[model samples]
Target: MGKVLTQDAQRFMVDCLKAVGAGKKPALQQAELLIEADKMGHHSHGMNRLELYVNDIKTGKCQPNNECKILKESEATAWVDACNVLGATSSHFCMDLAIKKAGKAGVGWVSSKGGNHNGIMGFWARKAAKEGMIGMAFTNTSPLCPPTRGKQPVLGTNPLSVVAPGAQDELFYLDMATTAVAFGKIEIQRRKGKPLHPGWAQGTDGKITVDPEEASKARILLPLGGGEMTSGYKGFGLAAVVELFCGVLAGSKYGHHVRTWSLAEGGEPANLGQCFVAVNTSCFAPGFQDRVAAIMQHWRSIEPTEPCLRVKCPGDRERRNKEEAESKGTVTYLDSQIKSSAALAKKLNVTPMQVTAE
Candidate 1:
């Protein structure tokens, strides 16, 4: 297995998936989405997730050939069924539809049910920002976080993301989970046999935990705040709001009722729900770009706590990361990760690459 740069690695990944049965366009899109995550410095949601997606396909939890359908539509909203297709494909389809509707109606909302993990939410939000619209997306998942005072994992790491387009170069974006950390973060630590920081999660009995492996099995992540006293209650509140939209509004499973991503034991998709909304700014104001530019300029002018660093907007770091990866021609991968990816490739009858392959 190799830790090839983002571009080459994604090309290989798309080719491998296409060879295995995914349609050309769908495979390519999925590969691009994952690689983009790596480039943006979020490895937990990047290629590491490809193994899960591929496994889901092999186990029949995610069908590469399934087609998503719009079950209902209205002037400002729609409901979609993924038909158990790959999450990336269904999410892209829905976001594109939402953008189209928003262009016509000034705003559009789309709710999707019966889909699996869709990777990072930023990818979809950025799609709308690129189209000159404000984009927002939210999703619910299997229980991974605990409520304010609970020790049991009673809530999904339900996440929300938003993107607002800027003038010419920058975009404002935010993507975060309702919990302090996602399951993937814990999983990564567990794989490395490392200890997690206190307050990130709680043991089964509601005690703070530091052992990642133990934490994964018996602990639940604390809500946005570690102990209720901190402002994490605000985060908890927002998380609940997302749950209402993704679960209650969509009539999907809520809180502890959701299912995990495992498939080997006959586990299927959690029938997760997601919400996507797009707002066309041109309908609301003329010269929106100029307005955005002025606001960001004012923000940057704020006195820096450290003179070496300048105040930056939300999307700036990601753009910088992408540029570095492109120029360097390679992205880093953990040694264990490369090995695991090799095993997966072999199991799927695909040839794995070396890091320095010409």
Candidate 2:
């Protein structure tokens, strides 16, 4: 039988976040965002990140309850200073503020500075879509991917997300990292002693590698499609665009200017940046909602070649995972993840989730 666990992972994560530094509803909201991602099978952005956050807090990279402040604002644009706030909380606040601004002006753009790594971008965009606004968000992270012609890690696995609202809380969403695989996913694989899939990364000496530990230590990830001949160029270009917005445009670090957290060294400075925009499709054309509905309907109506596979929209898989996790109580985490959480909680003087009876 598969391992079983109890307690809503969201609540437990929230408790731990609160116990550390999150300390309020914003932190709780951020915790839920990550927990939801894990439950929905986006393991790359899930509970595995908790240890990183804990290290961030302990090392002063993330502040507890340090709400970001607006550095500037206009009818359709804004800038925020995260004040070293947790990325999940800060990004959510920024996106909500943008959505509110867009409701008044029909569009809003906001760039943020000094934020830590937020969870998945789709998490925030879906919020705006749910509120009847078209949502888009982008973020930059520590350099983990090599540029098209370069061998060293210089660009972040910058991500982009877009969401459109539909009938019955249905949503059309696209959220993707610009890399073939995020470093976090690679790290998880390394911890589990698993091999990286073919075409995911290159070693320091510019050779393809499948050993996760080796990949983590001395390799750089390829772009979304693996190589230029395989459409990785497109993903590389998109990642650069986001970097321009979050780094150059926001006046923050770009390329290899970021520092990453490691368990041994504790939290270190990561001067990251991000951008978010909300569009009121209603402003662009009448019957925009109907048009979106039609577009998605047509996409989903496409016939599947294989009977076992069904047409899937960006957010569909995640939503289905959410349903399964809700019914099953807690999400199933790898043993390493369980131990990591326990260690962090013990260090912080809080009760961690009991992963197994042992």
Candidate 3:
């Protein structure tokens, strides 16, 4: 493992994005998105994804300088064309719009087409939460997860996030991929020379496999519950719901129509779909934040099934991770990540990230 100062990591990401043709604001915004993932302990979406963004820009698949436009709007809803901008730019614009509309209308819904990969969905959802409203974010990606009992992938991980702010700085935050695991986890395991855990993926033969290489090659992720008997179909259903909100509603690439997930190749623009929603709690109830905080506290007070492992509320782990990273002022990366980032910097002719002593 290698440790890097948080600012250095952000700078490296910004530099890499700029080197690949992204403008200053777009690059910095995108880098902020990636760095937040690292701070929250989601290594898969952090620096791990920098090369993919660079490739997208290099191949002209993403136009970081382009402007997003509203195609249609009502009192509480909007349809946006992201115009193939960087995911951070598009997501910030949409979520900000949602929050603004919710301030007056009590609820806001915005669906967008032509987005690129947008780091972690939770980051976007938390934006409205900070404004004392309930927030939701969803996005469609390249197809990588198979429906329950199916051999072929028909949906992306199709992540969703919901966040609500509470009193005393408490929160109810839930963000998850519909699949058993995000594809980035598989890539991380492969990078670490590790095997997959059972129930995570299937081989090309459609049977469960613990081999990371096989899982990566097959590109078939299981639904969250793993198999038919385990109710994996529930997760499959959730992925479909996200797709409905994103691709189907937004009229972008949907389901199998989405492109393949790849790092080495850039084809047509992803034209991916995304959705954001905000609901002003003040419109429906008073003391909303107090109630939310109480419930989270109650959950934490529950008896643990294992004494050593206490029960926690939805956002506790991520909050703890962020606090720890902040206290240290550093993020840790795998040796492979460090080496690859160095190679990327050399390729882009940008200054490499400086590592701190562990």
For candidate 1, the TM-score is: 0.91
lDDT of 2 by residue, 156-182 (tens): 789999999876457788988889977
Task: Note each model's CA RMSD in angstroms.
Answer: 2.6, 2.8, 1.7
Model 2 segments more than 4 A misplaced: 1-8, 184-198, 207-216, 264-268, 354-358
Where is model 1 poorest over a 10-residue stretch in terms of lDDT?
261-270
Top model number, lDDT: 3
The residue ranges of model 1 lying beyond 4 angstroms of the native Cα positions read: 183-198, 209-217
Which residue pairs come into collision in candidate 1?
A: 5-330
What TM-score, over all chains together, does every model reach? 0.91, 0.89, 0.95
Tens-digit lDDT string for candidate 1 (192-297): 9898876677788877788897788874887777667776567667778888877777776777788876536467565778888999999986888778877877
Deviating ranges (above 4 Å) for candidate 3: 184-198, 210-213
